[model samples]
Target chain A: MQDVPELVAQAREGRPRAVARLISLVEGASPQLREVMAALAPLAGNAYVIGVTGSPGVGKSTSTSALVSAYRKAGKRVAVLAVDPSSPFSGGALLGDRVRMSEHASDPGVYIRSMATRGHLGGLAWAAPQAIRVLDAAGCDVILVETVGVGQSEVEIASQADTSVVLLAPGMGDGIQAAKAGILEIGDVYVVNKADRDGADATARELNHMLGLGESRGPGDWRPPIIKTVAARGEGIDEVVEALEKHRAWLEEHDALTRRRARRAAHEVETIAVTTLRERIGDLHGDRRLGALAERIVAGELDPYTAADELVAGLTDGA
Target chain B: MQDVPELVAQAREGRPRAVARLISLVEGASPQLREVMAALAPLAGNAYVIGVTGSPGVGKSTSTSALVSAYRKAGKRVAVLAVDPSSPFSGGALLGDRVRMSEHASDPGVYIRSMATRGHLGGLAWAAPQAIRVLDAAGCDVILVETVGVGQSEVEIASQADTSVVLLAPGMGDGIQAAKAGILEIGDVYVVNKADRDGADATARELNHMLGLGESRGPGDWRPPIIKTVAARGEGIDEVVEALEKHRAWLEEHDALTRRRARRAAHEVETIAVTTLRERIGDLHGDRRLGALAERIVAGELDPYTAADELVAGLTDGA
Candidate 1:
């Protein structure tokens, strides 16, 4: 219930509970969450945020787990916000992203949490950043956002990161399914995970071919190196991390970090606007005047614009 | 540029060139186009728009072609607007949807045209409906709006249709993907395309289970039957037509059709507003003040909200 500023202050003071609470409140969209988020906004610019996204079985979770483990091994603090869309039958979901990095749960060096996409609005409107804020306050030097790989729309996750890593599996059928897909363009680093598998090299070669074909989405000599990773065996985790570091270097030089944050902030505002406007319309359901008008409109007795004006008029007069 | 009233009139008078030109002109942030669309607004409700969407390789084209042919066989004139996403480099695409219905194309009873989903916000937002309007006035009883398959961000097509058919392919590992996807919940009819493939029965049974588990989205008793179809063989097209007719009857009896059209009207208006706003920004691109602001925003020198507000203010202040 505390204001976001005070909560953010506590989080910056190294309070894990405070950071977690901020994240939970934002996810829940608690009434006062916005004011709190605004207060904490200024404290969020320090951490390196990397987003990992790919198809469902492309080893996103495994790659994330390996990278987090590597960062923790370097004695650096890290956090992971693994996003998954929840099931209709069960409201709760198991965030198995930490399946490979289980030791971190017992070790103090790493923190991982799973969040839901919640509903049809597939993009990360605010959940990812709010989680990032918590990670930043938790003193994590690096935070990784791993998308559930539903494709296309989930590209929002990568756009939010300082450096984006797009994951691909070998022999995933010529990678033709992804050839013209704009999702691959969001990558700052491409990882051919399950590299130990047959045709993994083929996937990598195809990715390099793709990188050569397009107008670069980013500046610099950042070719979005394809780091082949046997994530299950930790075979190429170091190389993946190296590619990530190279991206981080580019961000530092251009100072694109702030602009990235600014872009996300704008998107957050737009999404909130759209969702809020629609939500407000629901509150006008009961008035008979609007009801009759809706009925009449449905009965083809009146035009939609005229009907809408009449419906809103009742709300306005009532207000 | 004689204006929307005259253009809509000419389109109604069977001017194909006028209809195409109007749709192109109206589909952007151009003030003139918005003015024209507003003038032509009251004429949109006469079309029975059927939107068909599903994942790639689901045989959507084949199914659409069959339905159009079926309508033709029933002696009802039909118009098909198959939207295809273009290869970013080619700008040209084969709307091969006609391949399945090539049988009827020369009959003078069917009109099938493939429309491109112009990238970065073009056809989907504007041109589509204009094409629909032309078809509506051309004496077509059924206008099929075959949306370009945009996975995840697909609700746009549903919002625009009187009836929406969600086609799913069998053997797709993600039955759960479609179920929780909000797509299952939106469809007025569900078709299991490629039913000859292995595990088709299981996919249908699972879809039935999921459908049974949820509350219906509207006032329709039609359970969106899982019609099996090997569209390539022209199989089950009759069942698809039957399902569509059942939905039409449900809409007519329960008066959901008017409400559906109203909502579609609202969406069309919003699309127009957004498209017009974007075009306005595009037109003023050469203005030095806006250019500097855009450079600063993209370069991470300033937040987009601040930049956007300044641009809006500058435009109004007659700067």
Candidate 2:
């Protein structure tokens, strides 16, 4: 392994390979992870985290690419973390993501990484925030976390970011489906991508109607605005960036930024603590405690709830 | 708080209200859950568990209704547990489901229950199996576990059943999407519903083509067959029943049924144990241990990994 101080120095200087290696260590949960995180901790909390999520075939990748381009043009160092918790293989989707963002691959100002939810103890919910910390500490001005907006993990990703952008496209019947998926609650800014399509106006109208239906945010509460974008052609890219900036400003003005970061830190700490406890329980597998409990449950000697209580009592001290 | 013995007896006699009460206890994780489960344990393993899952808007509820009708025609008692882990209100989807299945709602031999994933410690993966036990103990010859084929929870539902049926519709591009969601691997039988639609044949052809791409099962191993049905009009309903029976027989003949049940039990046990430990940690929230650990990590005095290790040690007796 490379020296932790030297790697931290290189990463802070915006060396792509050094940043990549640090993220790898974080993802792999290496023995030196503590030292690496300790070195990076002071430099963290500088970059703004933005999350982009939407249903599949919704042009999320294209929209994300346009945002990266817009940020680069503004002379900001940007990082992209493409998170796919469902797919284990990085071959198909990651390859597609790379091909879509190939234009910026050679640009040193942009760092792109694809992370799958394989082999992670706490799933993407845990791995993503740590990766965000790495990028934030590595001197990036902005970081984008893009995940497929399908399940609970997507919601978790949205909560991890400073600004959550929910992307949708026209003619996908996504407006109603989005409501069913709880997308309306998590999105800070809604994007109707593929605005050049036929039903783009209808989709945007429906979204506005639904947003109106939500219990109105109180006075001074930020109202999420809908924007239309033809991401494939790079149209409306500037408006999306501007909306992000406005949301950030709103978050700061309302003093919601500290509250959000505090909530995020609490979640991370809980996840790590819970994961560690589960590992200890996992180590008890071959031991007689869990096995005896399972036997009693299987044999109808006790219910699983009781067995679980007994097992927990065995693991913990009375206090 | 009825007497557990009397409630179990009433449940075993196929009393609708008694069955409903037991399932509610399971869903609530009530204090009496353990007693109820203990009473129901011996009566489980009698019902044939079938899981129906597919993308939304694919007529899953309709197909489930058709299956209930077909099973009733065969003089077998049926129980339907519509497990919707995503929705909380149970207002829209469950109401629609109740209306669709109203035909069987009044039948003495048919019991239908809707379960939402709200406020469960272990989520649907833990709740669904216990609910199945309640239905199984109620003397139902067949239990249908229906879930939307979207996320990890759906896959967990599939594994809990003896036979998993993957439902798809024509022209939804669901063939490719199902493969991406890992739905293809979990299904023991595939059904292309809405077979009267325009692209029914194309959908079936694509499913068959994808099935062919998989590695060959050994000789005498069961190969999942793709069947077509227009479930709304009851068209081809008999074929789905026949396919399910064939798969069940295949499982029984190969000793796979026991293996599947064992695997399900192991998963349930592990989930319960892990959840119990998490609850203990949740109880530790107000204690200064977690707060101190968080402060150390946040202040860069310790990495989260090491902090987690220390927190775990603080909980255990060094065993």
TM-score of chain A of each: 0.84, 0.90
Candidate 2, A1-319: lDDT as tens digits: 7798998899899887788888888777787777887787777877899999888889887888899999999999998888865432132212334467878767889888878775757877877878888898889999988888877876788767999999999999999988887777888999999998999999998999988846667889888889999999999888999999999999899988766765576668778878766766677667777766665555556666666666666667532
DockQ winner among the candidates? 2
* Candidate models: Cα lDDT each: 0.65, 0.80
Per-candidate DockQ vs. reference: 0.14, 0.27
lDDT (10s digit) by residue, model 2, range B221-257: 8889889999999998899999999999999899887
Docking class of 1: incorrect
Q: Which candidate leads the pack in lDDT?
A: 2
Q: What is the TM-score of chain A in candidate 1?
A: 0.84
lDDT of 1 at A218: 54
- Residues A1-319, candidate 1, lDDT per residue (tens digit)? 5666777777676565676777777677677665655555445566788888877688777788789889988877777777666311112222233356555566555666777666523235556666676577557799888775554446776667888888889888636655545567788888888887899888877777777845565545556677888898999899988888877877767776666655565554444433443333445444455566545444445443354545444333433
